[model samples]
Target: MTLIDDRAPASVARTIAGISNGELSGSTCAPELTEGPWAFDLGMPGYGPGASQGDLLPAGSAAQGELPERYRRASGEELSSWIASAKASLGSRVAVMGHFYQRDEVVQYADFVGDSFQLARAARELPDAEAIVFCGVHFMAETADILTGPSQAVILPNLAAGCSMADMADIDSVEECWAELEARFGTSPDESGRVPVTPVTYMNSSAALKAFCGEHGGIVCTSSNASTVLEWAFERGQRVLFFPDQHLGRNTAKAMGVPLSTMPLWNPAKAGGGLSGEALDASRVILWNGFCSVHKRFTVSQISAARAAHPGVRVIVHPECPMEVVDAADSAGSTDYIVKAIAAAPAGSVFAIGTEINLVQRLAADYPQHEIFCLDSVVCPCSTMYRIHPAYLAWVLEELVAGRVVNQISVPSRVAAGARVALERMLAARPDTTMAA
Candidate 1:
């Protein structure tokens, strides 16, 4: 097992703080990230701070209320001590799962730290826990709610922490797209017994979208299992309509030898997905018009820059990046893939990673024997993931210790039932040892 040093060199949070105080000389993707997330809670309904700060939130999106003044004004040492005491008090009653993109301030308190899907899966291992405090984005908490037992209350440290890419594909838009596709190609299966279209939603989406896939003959896929899920879809459907993250769908399909001509981008803002009738008929994979703000920052030029700086540098990026970036890199896969690659590499190897700044920085610090740096020098992290401040973690954990479940995320039973079908399908389709490359 690879152990990431909890005491890894300066975290993103500390760097941002240092930069804001003029003690550090580096550019942050968003200066707004320097403020506490609560600062945006009342201004407008938006993704608070970080990389996704520029991305617009959907209409009628819920806004978080002001955090208590005590938490906001608490000192770092005070918050850390409070969190430790709360965790010690709660003991086995609660399990905290953190995502790789989360800032180290919050991540250090996590009992289990990994990607969203991996963290949700980890919830299963703590069946006796009364509550799961997920220090990730909203979708991640929803996922844990779906996967864990009903008794395990899944709590999100910050209610405003939401994935912008996931917000791009809503249940209404997906249903509309499905209706259009169904009208174009009726419900009849071909003689080969494959449905006309299979809805495939990335794990980053809302629970409602996962439920939609279950209600339909669709399935759910994580970044690690996207290829396997797509293969499963192809076996049962003539074509696939992948949603929430277009880059993941497109890159995965293209890697599977699906021609670009057969994969069309679906724009929900326009009627009929803004594609011609001929285009729809020819489509094998219909990708939604969505992308991760953080991942989208990476460009081919970054690869060239890294290569120029270090002659034998190995480049690796997450599949959520645009196809061009993935193609330009030495390899592309999930967060786990990048971690495993570094763990397996020679001590003298140089690596340039294209992903969130938090994970890249953590990885670089964890393996000091190798030279690891982020392809994009800008200190941009997943905006939503960055919302989880240590203050919020301390507050939530203290609440849990008091027998109160603050910021608890509970998916509706109806939605969870449908989403479970798709999630179980994803687990079943996962290969024994192989993962997406």
Candidate 2:
């Protein structure tokens, strides 16, 4: 079915109110919205935001399930009015930070928009802002929470909007893996000299994991600064255990000429099976066996197909893809890099993109003359990111205005101290600190 043809607006609209605030799974709330009208629109490569496309759904109708019981069913005009009122109500006390790949609906409310690391910095820049509404996933809010003061609280509109990539590694699993790594690899202790190993958790991980990194000498890193982070690790330790996403570690290491054999995958399900004799001996950068499902769907076959179908199609992908896929693509970088690459490209060029569907579709719409296509033929998106619906956004902001203040994500003081140490170490070590915003 055509992406537009399959959209059941009534079904999607009804599902909004039906969803529980904190519940994410189909069992808990809206019966796992696996397929819907919005999902259909996502299938259309390069289909942009509703407001951008002039398809803003009619608001404040007599229809019962179209909107919440409390507020007037909002039209584009009403939506605009509510946003203006919210800003007026909060004034400069509330600072909204949007992730680079956020949908236009959420991004529209952002006072500052940037990548993960830049968003962290953005939060610090607004230390005085009493409330920081983060328009990203759970971990991003956690990062903002850690970076900001105790006076401020970080809020996620949809509490369920989490990154599966982050979930792939937890503090428990990581601690277990590290104990095994230390016993097996036997790294010399860090600067404090008591701890045997350095735990370098990616910034895309949970705050608890960051606290673990902080408790140990491990630092947090994003796609933009993984190399600088690794360099710092090498100066301090014999080997670095990188977590959550493997491809990020591999690609970053490869760029620095660390041999593939040196990078071993740590599988949590396997007790001791993860450590091959060669893997332990040959490795410098140990990678956890995890991936971004959204990026994993972008195969070499899709790249080949896009190349054949649209001659001269420039291919780009996130570094979270496997080495073979990164080897095949024309370019690879963070989400911001992908957008900027397309923006700088000549108008006539055909570009095939690999990333989250929303950002790719948004790019295609923005650059209409140039043919832009997703690397995957099958319609798929980052399921975690899909949790942030417009209705949830409106509800969260309204709750803030009502003074109820639901879903405030705060990092524990001990965790924040540890996490801050790691983050500060990263910023100090990095020579060229410029990152995408």
Candidate 3:
């Protein structure tokens, strides 16, 4: 599983050779190669900024085809056996955590399966485990690294697994936003004892942005606790600058009765984020120009179609969805909230869920008593999250069993110290008892 090892089987190697020779299309290549840098170099479209290049790949790693093959060619049974054997070999030394949106093959091996925040807490709870193999995306692994003890190593099964939404708000762009805010609204608090703006970042953001929040008097928030976190911000500051996902900020603020006129969009590319000075001055919550691609795909028309086709159907969407879509749905909440809503519904209840397809499909299968389907008919899973294949999971686990740590994600102490402050604030901000969905 070490980066230097040649793990790919002869079949996979030959496939890669074929691809290089222009004899094979990406669709015909091994899934691992097609999903990694190889596909990017071959002019295949990728999901997001870092999908096929940059931070997605390990530092100093060779070409995707030349890199070690952990489980790219393993049969289903072989993968299962390898995973089981690795888990057994590692015993208490390793703990695997999976998000609810993860595929069944990967989730099946998780020691604890839950949302991003829950899984981070799970990592902290497992003090004895030396390694925390996170079967999610890069940001999640970074969060686990921040929360867990220094001795514990957090690993993302696949280096390419990165959140597109999170990548939208980099540290440089956010810092620039902060500078503009400072110039517009002085750094000092007003006579009412509230600062001009409070920086509130969604958990979907990078650790650097989280650190920015911590360094300032800002806080971090999850989908489940966003509203509560925002409420906390307003009390301390005259306005809030929310980042990474504008929809989450907009939806949460809207629910709190914050007027739409006061929530202005901030486009980093444009001067003053494309807002007039008047708009900036009037804004109570400034939303960053970003969104979850998966959630963004959901629309009001999808809701209309669901209602038309399935009479009396309840529509529940994630807050990451566009404001129009969220407004159209019967309810909006986090993935956990959606699960709880379905669990509490009557046996024969029909649900038109607007979120990741994998979660919806799993829910449909889990609750045979009710009818459930994604709002969008087109299969749309989080491309970044879906990057964490079972093959990668098996490879990482097996590597751990061999006492080699690969793809370890460690948040620098300087950054972690600041990020932890914001995360702790969210933890302290008690979430609203009423679930959205």
Per-residue lDDT tens digits for candidate 1, residues 56-120, read 89877756778898988887777878989999999999988888888877788889988765775
Residue 425 of model 1, lDDT score = 93
For lDDT, candidate 2 versus 3, the one ahead is: 3
Give the distance in Å from residue 402's predicted Cα in candidate 1 to where it truly belongs. Answer: 1.3
Residue pairs clashing, model 3: 7-69
Cα lDDT for residue 114, candidate 1 = 88
Error of 1 at 282 (Å): 1.3
Worst 10-residue stretch by lDDT in candidate 2? 55-64
The digit string of per-residue lDDT tens for model 2 on 211-327 reads 888777788888768878888787777778888889989888887888887888888778763577677767688888777766776788888888888887889888888888888
Checking candidate 1 for backbone clashes, the offending pairs are: none
lDDT of 1 at 337: 82
Q: Model 3 segments beyond 4 Å from truth?
A: 1-45, 48-67
Over 4 Å off, model 2: 1-80, 185-197, 429-437
RMSD of each: 3.2, 9.3, 6.4
